[model samples]
Target: MPSRTPSSALYKVAFLWNLFWGVPLLLAPSLASSALGLPQPAPGLGELHARAGGLAIVLFGWVYLTIGGNPRAFRPFLPIAIVAKAAFFLLVAFVCFFHRELLAMLATAVGDLAFGALFYRDWRAVR
Candidate 1:
C-alpha cells in the first residue's frame, strides 16, 4: 500500500481539530456564550445560535470524515481555511490581551494557529 501523503495527513488533522473544537460549542452553548461575553440570547436567537452551532458541529464532523476518506476533495478549501484560521487567531489574540474577556482568548488563538498550520501544510502539498 502507498504511504499516506502529506495532504492526506493534513486533512486528518484538520478534521480532528474542527470536530474537537466544535463539540464543546455544541454541547455547552451557555458556556460558549459566557466565553464570548454576549448577552444571553433572546428566546429566538437562543434557538438560532444553538441550532446553528449544533448543525455546524455535525457538518464539521461529516466534512472531516469525508476528507479523511478522500483528501483530494479538500484542495479547494485549504487556502481559504488557512486564511480564515489565521485571521481568527489574530482576532483572538487581540481580544485575549486587550479586551479582558472572561474565558482566555489565548486558547482560541492556539487552536486557530494549529488549524491554520495544518491547512498551510496541505496547501503546500498541492502546490
Candidate 2:
C-alpha cells in the first residue's frame, strides 16, 4: 500500500479542488460560467440548463468529498469517478476546440485532467 500521507494529501487536494468548483456552481452557476469564460445560457432554457448542471456538479462534489475522507471505504467508487473526470476533461476540450467562444473553459478541462491523474495515482498506489 502506498504511504497514507501522500495518498491522503492527494485526496485532500482533490476534495478542496472539487469544492472550489462546486460551491460557486451550486450557488451561482452564471457567475461560475462567467469566471470560466464559458458562454451563458439564455434566460429561459439556458438558465435552467445551467442550474441543473450546477446541481449535478454539487452532487459529484459531494462524492469527491466523501471519497477523500476515506478512500478505502469508498474504493469501489474510485475507478468510476476517475473515468468520469477524464471523460469530462476530454468532452470539454473537444467542445472548446470546436467553439472559439468556449476556449476559456479549457482551464477546467486541464484542472479536471490533473485531478483525475492524481486520483488515479492515489487509488492505484493502494494496490
Which digits, one per residue and each the tens of the lDDT, describe model 2 over residues 23-50?
7766777788788877666777887777
Q: Per-residue lDDT of 16-46 in model 1, one digit per residue for the tens?
A: 7666667656776666666666445556678
Where in model 1 is the C-alpha error above 4 Å?
A: 1-4, 7-9, 32-43, 50-54, 57-61
Tell me, by TM-score, which candidate is best.
2
* C-alpha RMSD for every candidate: 4.3, 2.3
Clashes of 1: 0
Measured against the true structure, the TM-scores of the candidates, in listed sequence, are 0.65, 0.83
The candidate scoring highest on lDDT is: 2
Please report how far candidate 1 places residue 119 from its true position, in Å: 1.4
Model 2 stretches with alpha carbons more than 4 Å out: 1-6
